[model samples]
Target: MQDTLHGDSQATGSGQEEGGESPAMDPRLIAEVRQAAAGDRAAFESLIGRYQGEIFRMVYYRTLSRMDAEDITQDVFIKAFRGVETIRDPVMFKPWLYRIALNAVNDFYRKKRLRSIFTLFSGDREEGQAPEEDRASERLERKEFWGWLGKFLTRLSAAEKEVFRLKYLDDLGIREIAEVLGKNESTVKTHLYRAVDKFRCEKELCGFLKEEKP
Candidate 1:
């Protein structure tokens, strides 16, 4: 989960690294998606286990609220379960799931805006639990990175920001991002190109990336 959350920020602006196509799906995972789509409860639960951690992390990154992330994660699976049979290509299950998640996050924000709420998520961790000593520093650094990245994302258009996050932060391939966003490959690339162009010019973030190099 931490690894997913702390994805390579430098990768965001590195053009075409993920290739134009999605990587081939594992046959077994494809089978699982197919079975789940056929109403097999166990298969659906298996899908949940496989993706829940990353889904939770993705949601947490967007909402910054542990509770909201948990609820949305559950809702994502519920919605997926209900609609799995509509999926034409089992190989597309991953991106399809992400599409659901991205929609759910957008809906979350929309509802908040509708209610005229100015304050966002609390982002608090559970009380009385401490991170392991070995991971503490890494967690703090990643937290700081997210804070900076969040600020930077505000400069991008909605399309550019979403493309950048899905590509670099969430490690989606271009085809997968297109599938998730309902855009074409070229459009995805265009948004990514614009985002990366801006990202490269961010001097402070570039300096931080240099320090982050191994």
Candidate 2:
């Protein structure tokens, strides 16, 4: 989750980076993905080692609960392990894994019958209630962006909200997002553009994001 993009630029249909660099998939990782798909236990374990933290963080960002995130992260990998061979292209391992995580999160919410995934505040707090000033300031600081973000996102349609999160927070490019959401690139772009238009109108949030963006 550094500034660097995760997958190969060309395979993802993104442009080359500065200095004319077009990063390719690492051969060793590609081998691991293929081996895991072919039922190599060690290779699958290696893949788990590389992605576990990222998967956990992604789940944590959505769930906002360590316990739920951990459970969902485990379930996501379990499902992935069972279905790895279904992934036809090695270049798509990251997005394929992400798709699994997204479904797992949705299923979690569906069973719980909780608030929409768009809700930002955690715990027993009611939506639209201001959190007590002294409550878990450190954790709030970490998630502060989302607190501000949830306000703007409330006005967006479901498709727009998701497209925005995938593009900006999840750091998936448009093509990868389309693959994950089972949508066409043009559809993804339309949603993303509408979301961006809404986001640009929120001057305070836009300025805050500019200052906070990594």
Output the number of the lDDT-best candidate.
1
> Per-residue lDDT of 10-77 in model 1, one digit per residue for the tens?
43235446555666777989899999988889999999988887787788778766667889999999
* Model 2: residue 165 alpha-carbon error in angstroms: 1.1
Per-residue lDDT tens digits for candidate 2, residues 1-214, read 1122243223222343312222467999999999999999899999999888777767866766666788999999999999998877887998899899989988987866756433435545443223323343545544576677777888899999887877766667677778889998889889988989898899978887788767
Deviation (Å) of 207 in candidate 1: 1.9
In model 2, the Cα lDDT at residue 186 comes to 88
The lDDT for every candidate, in the order shown, is 0.81, 0.75
| Shift in Å, residue 175, candidate 1 | 0.9
